[model samples]
Target: MREFKTENIEVAYADNTIIKNLSIKIPIGKITTIIGPNGCGKSTLLKAIGRIMKTKNGAIYLDGKNIYELSSKDFARQLAILPQSPIAPEGLTARELVSYGRYAHQKGFGKPSEKDKEIVKWALEVTNLSELSEISVDNMSGGQRQRVWIAMALAQQTDMILLDEPTTYLDVAYQLEVLELLENLNKEHGCTIVMVLHDINMASRYADYLIALKNGNIVGTGTPKEVITKEMLREVYHIEADIMIEERTKKPTCISYRLNNRKIAVEAGIKKGIKVVG
Candidate 1:
């Protein structure tokens, strides 16, 4: 099992800094969820760790070694990342796309080896795409397409996987379906899963470890019970919410929410030299 730790990393796009100096240690062999508001740099952090986005300052360490020190193939073997919107090449079959995962292991241009073919078949089967394997990715539904991409990542056979908003375009039921599949992958294979989630309730329910971010900064990192508190909701989201516990899962759920008008009213009061009361 490979764990990841970052040290004071700063991620930027052009002149805009999406993530400030941030340090985090993701536990080995557990499902970790990174959650925050829309512009909170959650995806930037995921990409940085996956080496898809470069950090201007500081380093990301995978399995205690600096990630930059590892070769591309070595890094791919240790960790894999799936982005929010992956563009599949037109006319690429699901099986063909999944087979790309084996590229890192292939030597000097030969056809897929027997072991590679076995892995690709296993990935397709595990993702329930055995029949869809020959179908074009463009012809699949959103959920099915997402599963195909996930199958590719699984074929990579990395110890850790990173995904940015794996359930974005799907409906609530499909979202739950995808999350359940990820939970199974983590449990059955002992894979370390890290993902960025926009849904707080879903993140709380499925995550073994939760990391909350705000304004490109860390807010809280712990179990859902510790990070999904009412106070945390107020602080990170500026939303007044009622935190409820699910009966069976015992996971923290936000049953109600309303805008915290206090901030706006307080600022208005200050402008008029009037103190606002709660």
Candidate 2:
């Protein structure tokens, strides 16, 4: 297992800084979900950690060495990132897309070796896409397409996988299917999984650890039982939420929530230069 951590990092887009002085240590071999309201810099943090974007300051370390010091192929061999809504080339079959993951392991000309082919086949089997390997990605359902993308990542044979909102547009059933597959990946193969999720209940149900962010800062980080709370919802989302512990999985669940009018009114009043007494 490898260690991944960021040290006091800052990320910016031109003049606007999105994340400031952030530090995080991703627990190895676990499913970690980053949650917060929109525009909290969750995706920005993921991009930096995945090396898809650069940080303006500080260092990201992989197993004690700075990530910038590693070559692209070397880095890709260790971790794979599946961006949200990845688009495949038209007419590309599931197997064809998965074959691309062998790029880093290949030498010049990047021909698929027998070992690469075998690994790709195994990835398809594990993802339950072996039969659909010949189907064009564009012709598949949303869940199938997502699995194809995941199979591509799996073919990389990385110890860690980073995903951004893997269930964004899927229907509820497909959402559960994807999350269950990820759970199996963690439990069976021991892959470290990190992703950003919009649904608090889904995140709570699937995640072994949760990192909650608000306005570019980490507001809470812990297990679901510790992080998913009424106070956390109030602080991070400005909502009053009812929390419960699921009996089957023993995970925290957010059953109901509504906007906190008093908090909203106070902030609005303060912004308008009114003396508000609570």
The candidate scoring highest on TM-score is: 2
lDDT per residue for candidate 2 within 1-278, as digits (tens), equals 47999999999999899999999999999999999999999999999999998999999999998999999999999999999899999999999999999998999896799999999999999999999999999999999999998889999999999999999999999999899999999999999999999999999999999999988999999999989999999888889998888999999888889999887777778889986686
Instruction: Please identify model 1 stretches exceeding 4 Å from their true place.
Output: 264-278
How well does each candidate superpose onto the true structure, as a TM-score?
A: 0.94, 0.97
Please list the residue runs of candidate 2 whose C-alpha ends up more than 4 Å from where it truly belongs after superposition.
Answer: 268-275
lDDT of 2 at 120: 99
How many clashes show up in model 2?
0
lDDT of 1 by residue, 1-278 (tens): 55679999999999999898899999988999999988989999999999999899999987679899999999898788999989999999999999999988888799999999999999999889999999999999888888899899999999888999999989988898789889989999888999999999999999999999988999999999999998888777878999889998999999999987896577568889999996
TM-score of 2: 0.97
Error of 2 at 226 (Å): 0.7
- Model 2 residue 101 distance off true place after TM-score fit, in angstroms: 0.6
Cand. 2 Cα-lDDT: 0.94
